[model samples]
Target: MNHTLLRLIIPGVFLTLATGCVTSTVDEMVFDEPSEGIGDATVVILGRRHASDYETEPDFIECVGKHIAARDKSIEVIGELEFLNALYPWFEPRTAPLKPSDIDKLMLQRPVAQKLTALKTEYLIWIDGSTVRNDSAGSMACGIGPGGGGCFGFGTWSNDADYEATIWDFTDRAEVGRVNTKATGQSYMPAVVIPIPIIAPVQGTACDGIGEQLLQFLSGHY
Candidate 1:
């Protein structure tokens, strides 16, 4: 067995396992093979601003950062806090929302680009989207109209979470790829007393799916 055979066999095992977990779609928007490639560069994962509160879940952000870091040893992964610090007022979600064009302009600025260059931020991953309650059926009832009232009924609801992770190559100054993740789950609330929790697996699924695909891209595996 040669080095090439080992490389092929080992990574294939990981990829197989990764693909089995979630449904991931990768779209390569503009890919021009870089001369130096993604060798040991810094990768920043960021959550985009949204009006909805659930869009910026800390758990989801951390999940992605941790998984991406774990996937590749050579590359440096920057967490949400550090990345936000680097962007400062411009990327703040509380204020006006920013479009890709706005970011493109900022990157074109010499000072901004120089600052990011100093950080060795070769790739920028913009993560957005949320999991939300889709529909509800049945209902738990409680009423008191000047008289003692106690009501009970079983209720059920479902949640759907969809997310997208877009990759931008800072060195190339262009959008390179994107990963889309969608997951839906159901849960039931028994009576008006006991609450059953059915956690939607979207964030975990997105983290795993996006992280694996990104690892493959940066490591030149897929």
Candidate 2:
């Protein structure tokens, strides 16, 4: 990215850590610039899963996709449905998520390569991980009655999320970049007549951090 801005940011990022150990660590690595491919490049964001039943949160995917599309106006961002439809047979009746090895195999095949290239898909971004409730203190219990459900409690909990985005360059049949984001923050949820929602904003954090980093890497800024 902007080396000057990066230099300035490094100090601030480090300083923020001194105040609290619960923080986010975002690491980014870019191998080579894909300048020639950006103009007509289409990217599909996939969630890498170990189990067939597992699913990635749609909101998180949408957030990251939206940010990437906004930053790179020329790049076409494909949603999950479009991606699945385009790769129909590859996913057929039953199968587990495509591991990195599987992706490599598919990319190296002539037919697969030709199909994706025809569709103008230059990169595939695979995201893995989730946000979870780490710890909770106090209680928030609700019950339904004739008057409806109501509960009372004063409680706090921590949300910790870790996600990694791996960018595979279909043109080169190799991974060109990766971004890892770890975020942890406290959340507050209270119930008077209804529970007050306290969002940790982990997904948003990961999206913004990874999205910007991905854009910079793609544009040769990093």
Candidate 3:
């Protein structure tokens, strides 16, 4: 990790209430996921690193990050950005713009370009470029309400989403496989008493459901 870049990022991250709240802990589902054993790999959960995005609550990036960190930093847990040394150097927080970064220019450095190093990481796991939004209002209404319904009902819901994952080997530093998986799950909340029927209940959260799908997918891959 670049100390210079991390310093700027850590403060920015701590600004958010949830920042640093994520423990480098692993989830049982992800940590126990079987790995044939990546020769030498480091994987990262990639997405919005900006603090603003994470403050919104239920960020998938945390799920992915914690999922790896909890696994004892082994082959199963990896950082995706290790692929960008010659490509997207700006991920380091330098004053560089994204113009100099080219995903295509980077190759898996693990087994091909360099030997897997323990300190730097040798595997990269990417969460992919995609977002999941809850469009199931009906579910929310039925899930919550006057004697409301199940947590997955009208106001209770778990949504399905698709994020393309590109797995790269840091040892070879070359991408090995890409998988498109749907993360799905549900979050339950109490019915907020309001002034009128026109009141909008709390926003039914469903992002974690989509995240769970990603974890499940990881379980299958190993």
What are the per-residue Cα lDDT tens digits for candidate 2 across 1-222?
699999999987755542322467799887865765477668888776554544556678778888888877777889866777778767432542354456666765687667787878877888887777768888877789987889888688787778888887776667788899988877777689787655566667777887887777665433
The positional error of residue 158 in candidate 3, measured at the CA in angstroms, is 6.5
In candidate 3, what are the lDDT values of residues 1-222, reduced to their tens digit?
Answer: 599999989876644422111111112223223255533434455543334432222255556556544543443543334434433543443422222133323323343223224335533445433443465454323235577444332243344344444554444435555444444444333343421122121221122433343444444333
lDDT of 1 at 133: 73
lDDT of each: 0.67, 0.73, 0.40
TM-score to true structure, per model = 0.67, 0.74, 0.39
Q: Taking the tens digit of each residue's C-alpha lDDT, what string does model 1 give over 1-222?
A: 699999999987755543312233444343544444477678888887675566657678788778866766677888778777766755677642244445567766687767777888888788887767768888777666676665577766676667777887775566777777766666555655444434445456666776776666676544
Over the full model, what C-alpha lDDT does candidate 1 score relative to the true structure? Answer: 0.67
Lowest-lDDT window of 10 residues in candidate 2? 91-100
- Candidate 2 lDDT score at position 156: 81
RMSD of 2: 9.4
Query: What are the runs in model 2 whose C-alpha is more than 4 Å off?
Result: 1-22, 35-37, 51-55, 91-111, 141-150, 220-222
Best by lDDT: 2
Over 4 Å off, model 1: 1-37, 50-56, 93-104, 107-111, 141-153, 191-194, 220-222
Cα error, candidate 1, residue 123 (Å)? 0.3
lDDT of 3 at 126: 51
